[model samples]
Target: MKPIFKRPRFGTTSTAFWAATIGLLLIIAAVAGWPNPVIFVMGAILLATGLLIWQEITAGLWIGLSVFGLLTVLHLTRAATYFQLRYLIYSLAFAQLGYECWRGLQRTRDGIDSEDIDDENGDGEEDKPMISLVLLQRQPKYLENMILTKVVESAWGGDYSNSDAQSDDDADDGDGFVVGESPMFVIKAPAGMFLVHNFDVPYWDNKDEVVEAIGELRLRNAVEEHTAWLSVDMLTPGDEEPDLNEAYLLVAKLLTALADEDTLAVVRPESLDLNVWSDDVVARLLTPGAYEELSLPDNAPVIPIADDAPEMRAAIATAQQRWPEFADAFQQRASHDKADDGPSFVVKAKITAGDSTEFIWVDVIGLEPKFVHGHLANDPVALGDLKLGSQVEFPIEDVCDWCYEKDDEPVGLFSLEAIRQIQEAQQTNEQ
Candidate 1:
């Protein structure tokens, strides 16, 4: 079954239809001797309201309502002299404006609740995919031009064309550029049109899951404090399943070209999955078969360190000093959820055998005043007999760093921060 694609209905067709209808009615009223100053004022106000609505501006409704109320009071008080027929026509036009206002509010509410609406075919399914790219910084000024240029260089180069003007009639105002409800650029492709919009941070329904995904991707700090995001939505031409592969490829290309280190994360809102921008990941996305195959693992592989540096030693000293606080929180969480598996707790400690010492993450099962009891979370490269998941006990003084999942977010990863700083320094030096 073909998935139903849904989006906001405000487009060029509706805008043009309303404009033409209003223009024709105003012309007829003027020809019929209803061209008084009051009539002209009402016509101008109506035209202004239409233009505001075309730009998807919500303030237009209040403006339209205030003018309608003012005109009604003037007509009743005999302060303004306009023909009765003209008044009736103006009243009907105001009624249409009121309806548009209500509809716009409904659309806004729906968007807040869910970006992708349920299938109208009554299947209780939404097969269409929508991807959002979360960014730590505002998009570059020439993003629209960059997107167009990249699309023209892709395999589907000639298969797409810019349609920003057709999708949004008031995209460019006459005097100065007026930003509408949101800054967006539209591209018409063979399968459908792609709507790319830059907006403020969205309300994620699966916020905890998203946080968990970010933690797994080792990008918690990068996106944890983001203020803005970009959404890429595919609008199918009709009731046909969109070319999913093409959409993925196009999005991948855009990510490769536009996403910098500051580009924090990418997420499929419908599934609440974080995606890494890499060639291997893109190849997996383009593979055929079940969608379940595309789901990334929750836990990322443990990153290795060849030798402890000054930063690592400092992090370890800090963790030792803060061990009391960690123990208090760990005990509290364990007491709170004792009936269930409880929160995930891990501690990084040094393991020594003969002359070699290695630091590894240990899955904490219990904690004592002087010791931490747990199993190794990862394989040791230097240690011969110490395998992954091997039960181990270590002195609390040897703990280098500690972390645990709290509400799906990783907290107290001190060593992780040091690692990030070291890597960043290396990159800076190379550049």
Candidate 2:
């Protein structure tokens, strides 16, 4: 697991107390001519705290801290006789700590706090709720008006009364106004208010490796060629029961109005996952209680509603029809052309035993004349002894779907898409 780092919030009275305590300890160590283990232990603790909890430690800081720690330990163990040299090193470490504390105090006085710190890990504990969209084309003129109109017409109905609109002519005229760079608008809804804005820079500007590592192939491809992006952040604060349902609906409508074939991807940054979007995807988004369901942890498995639904059959047919494309892509993978493209390339196929049949993901390891060979990516519900990572082979005709990451983008996900479509249709029929 990756180590999670967080910035320390300074400028508190406790910070002032620690600063004074360290200063007193340093003074005691310098006057006594004795190796102050307390000071050394404190130094080590501070360095560790700075590294793991505070600001991102630089290479220079790391080296300095490491040397200080090593020397302190050596001095404590009575392995060194260089008492003067040890005192000098201790003084330098104290100076560094004092400087950092002073900097923190200065920042606090300027109203800058821990919130200014970049939460790179995206654990979402400290961040606000937000939805972001990236597209391959710039949005149309009067984007705010378009979004508001769509939101009002959606399943979760709401209206935005724009105070900026002057006269009837201004509201009706085609030559109303040109949207400036990074235009922001407030949307007043039944749930609460939302802030929508277009960003000047694309969100995925320098994060190519992140996208690739996460297996968001579609999102990766979109970012590579994206021209525009926007964010919708919930503005109304809530204690317990926030209007998350309406917020999702608002995003759904926004996507309905703005998203097209050119739209790249929709993302909830807090969740740190790329949402797959289709025309029918909006229907799923608008369903009651979907927000809570989607907000579940990423590790949870998504069980399909049915194994033999029409959408499943349709997905299998589509994958078979597009089998040539998968074969060609596989051939590319076999060659050095697509080396190290992703972690795994797998296909979903049907497995049967007794009275049970289930579709399972299988990692692609080799190819045969009439069969695709690989290990099972998922444990079977019915098949015994054969567990996850077990070698499995299936004929080409039984393959329902295939997915591989190439060029930092996902290539095929027919069955996954079909499952979503199936869920969307079912929800719609129920309504």
Candidate 3:
């Protein structure tokens, strides 16, 4: 058997290949009826061939059925005896199986042509940490951005936009703010990071001319009453020299004079070691007898409005008769006790004198009708040591009720007048 062994192959040409394959299948099928162990041997051969090339086996079977089907139809029409019904059925089955195998082979060989494309979220790059200081000192010739940056970084670990507008930016802000020592120690403050700057007042001759002291007093008052922080400061001698030594003395004097435990102010300048503010400056302004109504500061001009002096009662009545519009303005203001013991009026005057402009308010004050003094906006020249009455042309400040309180930040001068009226009415019986 080893000597006679041979490997069978398919085809010499395309037509011959098909014919041989068909012939080989036919021979294998009929070989089962032969003598010896031929049927078993053929079965073994078929199984072995199928195992070796299952795809080919199934394809051959399909083709055989297709041919059988075509041949069976013709054979039946012709009444052919070669067309046995059982053989025809077997042929059909084999042909179908062979066609299925061919289709499977084509599908596997062709493969599912596809391209793998992946976009990893196309996960974006990680976000960057915020910059703590972003000072935009546009055309900042004098003020250094670095100074603000360091100041911010040294104290608070936050962000900074501008030197003044922190919190808005993403920069480190110092934990505490440092108060300036001098003329800059004044300014009206509502909120407190306890900071201040940006002021241009008439240049000061005397230290009192600087507004820091007045600002501190207002701050102390606000703090006691509202428990709010006030960044009150005026212009200092120079931006360069913060001189905390002088600052310390002045602070001690100012605090000792203004100390009201209800209000507290802490100062921290880079001039101090470590720049930490721990101590309290005395609230010297809190001295009991020290509380004085904000009045016309001494040296304020005196504009008399009386025959002997100004008849405020008659003048007010006369004003109502003359400037009826102002009369309405006054009445709307004084709702509760507007009706006097008699008639009232509104008096108005327009004055243009020198560089300073002022609004002089008048009504009955004491026995004489004098200038109504409260918080009046005047150019430095207006508040003067005037010569006897140098024909001082006194006009009302253009305090159109709208721009009265530094433009409504504080109430208008009228509110103060209302308060005065209340005070006067309360004290009239005493007088």
Per-candidate TM-scores read: 0.37, 0.37, 0.17
Over 123-231, each residue of candidate 3 has an lDDT whose tens digit, in order, gives: 1111111111011111111213344334333333343323332231212333333322211221111112222221122112342443333322322222223322212
What's model 1's lDDT at 282? Answer: 50
Q: Report, for all candidates in order, the number of backbone clashes.
A: 0, 2, 55
lDDT of 1 at 232: 56
Ranking by TM-score: 1, 2, 3
Query: Model 2, range 60-112, lDDT digits (tens) per residue?
Result: 23443454455556544432344333233344444544454555546556766
* Model 2 lDDT-worst window of ten: 173-182
What are the C-alpha RMSDs, in order, of all predicted structures? 18.9, 22.6, 40.9
- Ten residues in sequence with the least summed lDDT for candidate 3: 129-138
lDDT of each: 0.54, 0.54, 0.31
Ranking by lDDT: 1, 2, 3
Candidate 1, residue 16: lDDT: 26
Model 1: per-residue Cα lDDT over 44-125, one tens digit each: 6667765665555556555655665555555434312433322333344445545545645566556532234344542212
Q: Counting only residues 3 or more apart in sequence or on different chains, how many pairs clash (N, Cα, C under 3 Å) in candidate 1?
A: 0
